[model samples]
Target: MELKILKQDFSIGKLYDVSQADLQNEFCFFAKTDQENSLVCPTEFMPDDMIEREDGWRAFRIQGILDFSLIGILAEISSLLANHKIGIFVISTYNTDYILIKAENFERAVRVLADHGYEIIH
Candidate 1:
């Protein structure tokens, strides 16, 4: 699969509450589990009242729409990155998956992936 890199740096935050705008962004991910409400968005969009946060993530979008029956695409990518000692954060939409990695490791991750024969669309 080809990966499309998103230029924006992102922040993941845990918030007590979120407005509808939080989930209606041009590009974002939000979820509420029993523990806390979580949101991932470009740094500029993060709210002021986050209970916790982690910053410096750059996103990569897996190109093309993914079918439900397709399996192991993420696992294969994750395993490759894992072997290179790079950590990742992942989110899936109904169509495709997004993978996030710390900005510091972005270049190396790209190189490793390129060497492994996965095409990256910048």
Candidate 2:
């Protein structure tokens, strides 16, 4: 259960699912319509359009060693956010997990995670 947290700033951008045929990398889009809506690796990378909007988004890093051996990591995180009425989009890589919260609930979600004993890097 050892976790290393990193405080990094990331722009909260809008994600839109476009037709696979219409996608272009220059557009900064994330995934195609056929891909799952959940977090995806940058490697299986698809066209993700990063749009600048008036709304804000929250991005955080959960670094350190993770145990894939531990079941329910996603379930635990989802449940934690659910209790606070926050929604999340989770992406994972070989090393760690990245959780994206809507811009509106970003602060509250961070606080809740901190209160629950997860270290807040920032």
Worst 10 residues of 1 by lDDT: 18-27
lDDT for model 2 comes to 0.55
Q: lDDT of all predictions, in order shown? A: 0.89, 0.55
lDDT of 2 by residue, 46-97 (tens): 3345333323335665666567786787787789999988988765756667
RMSD for each of the candidates = 1.3, 6.6
Residue 19 of candidate 2: its Cα lDDT? Answer: 43
lDDT digits (tens) for residues 28-115 of candidate 1 = 8999888888999998888887788899999899999999999999999999999999999999999999999999999999999889
Question: Cα miss at 7, model 2 (Å)?
Answer: 6.6
Q: In model 1, state the lDDT of residue 106.
A: 92
How many clashes in candidate 2?
10
List the candidate 1 regions with Cα displacement exceeding 4 Å. Answer: none
How far off is model 2, as Cα RMSD?
6.6
